[model samples]
Target: MGMGVMRIPRSAFIWISLFFITLILANYGKLVADAISMNWLVKYPKVWVFPLKDYVSLAMQWLVEDATFGLFTFTEATRGLSWVIEQPYNFVRALLSEGFERGLGKSAVQVLPPLSWLTVLSAVIALGHYAKDWTLAAIVGACFGYLAIFGQWDSAMITLASVVIAVPIGVGGGLLFGILAYRHHWFGRLLKPALDLMQTIPIFAYLVPILFMFGFGPVSALVATVIYAMPPMVRITTMALQSVDPEITDFGLICGCTQSQMTWRILIPSALGSLMVGVNQVIMLSLNMVIIASMIGAGGLGFDVLASLRRLDIGGGFEAGIAIVIMAIAIDRLSQAFAERSTSYVHPKIRNRIYHRHPRSMIVLTVLIFSMVVGFFIPMYQHYPESHTITTGAFWDDSIKYLNINYFDQFEAVKIFFLKSFMLPTKRFFIGIPWPWMTCLLVFIGWTFGGWKLALMNGLMTLFIVTNGMWAKAMITVYLCGVSVVIASVIGIPLGILAAVNKRAGKIIGAVIDTLQTLPSFVYLIPVVMLFRIGDFTAMIAIVLYALAPAVRYAAHGIRSVSSELIEAGIVSGCTPTQILTQIRLPLALPNILLGINQTIMLALSMLVITALVGTRDLGQEVYIALTRADTGHGIIAGLSIAFIAIIADRVISASAKNARIRYGLETTHGH
Candidate 1:
């Protein structure tokens, strides 16, 4: 076998995969297809297609109107960086919803006034009781007083002034590209496949190259929410500065310090609690890219939940998707209570005699200078009046129009009993298979889970979606993200094994998977399109409630990370507790429930591209019809064929979880 590889015999590719599945169940499915003579092996042949979206729209119209670097012209250096990020996003949306004006329109002259809704609700209940306490300062003071009692306080304060300037420039450009990819090894191997193609593409394929390089408004939605919340804070600051503790870098190099004071005082204060969980995942992915950065203009509360979900107005888009889940649970519990707190430690001369020691920032700078000096003689303390607000958007559109006029045939008989028993027989058996025998059965199951370079990179990225014609909309985006990640891992792995063997059902299934992982996939398509209305069975019940919190937080953290001395050596060898939860905690929680079903199939293919605006043509409705026809080469070839089908289902579920931990020897075939 000269240089042309051979190595076939894995029981002769398991009898050629059981005679190619008994010749596709004897021609019914037709891998050996021939509609007439060979109807292009199950349909892909419109004369071998592949304009590749008019050669990526003439190389993005010559890189946005004839490229250049010297003496400007790449559209005048992106319109001078969209007028330098629209001057601090129009000075934090006019210091939180119109309060400062000068002299131009109506020959302006307000001067300043914005801080009042009782001084930004007493500075968000004194920064939620100085980050953590008084019951998270009374649950972020009743979710910042339900955005000024529901009239969605000026579009939730202009989406909290573009999430306070896109979370400090996405946590200081993810800690300066996580400290230049942890002090450069070829810049952490070219910054990890460009942060895994900026976290597997598709927040509307990052607004068609940020509306062709920041051309749209609100500084192209705050530079696509700071490049989609800076790649998980540069992969959580190069994994919290490469998990610090090497004897605190040899006691700051035996105290001779200075490599910038041992990387800023011994590895960034010993990696400030894992860089505050990457600043709470860049404040919940910049409030989950503010409802797809409000299709690139970005007003706030994701443009009032995309103009109340495009006027179907499910109670004004479920009160702007519950004021973006109460400002993402009060800024994810005040940035996780200011990264697990630390206060009472003063000593340096009583910390320079309590140098204005933030008694909740001196009571939010004395209630924002006594509500801007009583909002210059009370105009309802400077604005909170719209005829004294409070609106349940017509009481959630008259209680979902009286439950679609008395439970429209019991929600159309439970969406026709889960679409004629399981989403139209799993979308007609994945669009009747045969895309050349489902790309040679996923390239012989990625060459039986990882080999021959993942079966030639899974038969060339599943034959580039059948030569880019989009094989039946990428098999209806893999049967609606594999039946919404197998019904959210069968109802989130038994409510995560009853929240890991009951401590009151692990605090009620850990407060219902922490408020369903702080809502956002466009607020699970407004109460399942108001109790199931749209198709593909309301996009598989809003992608199984936005992929049920990573299958109940990776099955209650892989059955509470087993090994309590192997449950006391299986209770002294006479095991019980159902033989210690089915033979040692479900076979050591099957590699963390196969990494929580690979993060519930990458959050059910990123909530199936926002369930293509509640219809289902897939590849997220061709990246939302190439972001309404702007078409950056058909939205980057349908957002890189949904990032090459989430990188070939995350490399065939990480090589089938490393061949099931090397057939349960729990890994070790040679590499150490």
Candidate 2:
């Protein structure tokens, strides 16, 4: 008698209605499109397409050829900037890997060696131990030792030289901008979306314009690397600075500090630990771009890997990839340890004497000088002799040969099974969706998740893709990324649950995921390309390997984050372990799990540009092709399509997660 009508929130009602209407209209519109000969609705027609990419190209051209400042044309200005950037790169390279020459012109001869391997190794080990403990020092030492022992020392140092130059620049620039944003609300408002867009745009897309401005050389590569690696640092710095305790801020003000003094003396010092996290991120991301940077003449180990990949030299690629991984692990762990040191170190004023203030630095300097002196007398110490170096290149190649010889049928079967069952079907379905219908559906989803603002954003972005005649390729990119993410989540979520519930499992899985996360995107492609040959399947595997860690991490964190009281209540209710997980834990953890999915999607798209090398024809390929042709328009447009897809998915899923968190009383947000 009391069930006349049920009340629903305005949001719930609109979304519910929008969902059904979108579904019906999207599907029915396809049939209508076919009847009306409206092929534009199915595939964006070239004749009617917008020339966004062309517009972008024209602007870039003007900058390169016509724009000027003061006495210099834009080209001259850019060349000057490039020259300035190269000075540091050259100095570092000379110090670490190339060494110096005496005399001038053709009469020059080798006058000094690059820092001896032993010296650099000693420096790294001492710094590691001083930063943390012997455990970390040992790890760092072994990573460096491997490079020398395996004949990668020379190339590795070249890579290191570039990273050394790039990290400081990236971290410094990001911090400066981040502080400006934090100090000015209006600036922060303007900066937030710019950072988002910068992060979303693939590194390859920017390289086109950068290559145009700076010309092909290490300077351009360094510039691209800095741009690619800086966004996270900026975001992190703003967050960390803001998170500083208010009491600390008040103390500095009470001490009659100026605004600058309160900031540098108080807020920044208190936020040092978190700022170190940004530094660590910058280090890792800079390393991740090593291979990508190589394309623009940043030559080093990245060039080695790239050459090997192009030639299908599995052994060569594997060896270089391992070297990259080792370098990354050493740098990553050392940076993390430094972050810890930042947390624990006493203030400079608290320490007396230079030795006490920088004991590690003194030790390193002492070892460095001694090594160089001894190395001058002993050529073996100055340079690793070719005869003494060991290599695993042939071994890796042989192993691949063995696998192919022994398991060719099995490998083929697995690839075919996944392609036939999951991959192709998803690809066909996504590509088959009418562009207009897909656009409408996404707009509805955005509205359902995040109200009109998100809906408008989604609609406009989707339309841009459609009107630019990129719908087919964009959908192909979507399907590849979508399938890869689905696969990663399927593999990662379960392991995450097991890890959450069992300590031993958690330890083992955590170790594995940590290693996976440490490997750069390029490294993932080496073995995958070796076993599977060049195709979408290989790309999918590589994407999965790259994306899996986040899914596992987030899912485990979510499940473990569930309140202990809830678990106890379930036990008190006589619930089974599985039942508690299936009901209470899973429901409460849905928001976190959704966020994990969002991350997985982001990672999958990031892999797209790298995976393009394996012969996939997604937007990544578009970017790569555009890069080669120096076609800024094509690259930027394609990159925008990919970025828009990722950003839209991120916004919708984030909104959904926020709603779920609020419903569970885990958040108290009152605004969208």
Best by lDDT: 2
Q: Give the C-alpha lDDT of model 1.
A: 0.80
Predictions in order: lDDT: 0.80, 0.89
Q: Which structure among the candidates has the greatest TM-score?
A: 2
- Per-candidate total of colliding backbone pairs: 0, 0
TM match of model 1 to true structure: 0.34
Local accuracy of candidate 2 as per-residue lDDT tens digits, 1-672: 677687898978877886676555445656777899986776677898888888999999999999988798999988998899899888899999988888878998977778888789888998888888999999999999999999999999999999999999999999999899999989999998888888888999889999999999899989999998999899888998899988888888889999899878898889888999999889888888888999999999989988888888877887888899899999988998888888775556557788888787888788778778987787777787778989898998899889999999999999999999999977877776777667777887877778999999999999988888788889889989999999999999998989999999999999999888877688778778778988999999999999999899989999999999999999999999999999999889889899999999999998999899889999999999999898999999998888998899899999999989988888888643
lDDT accuracy of residue 54 in candidate 1: 84
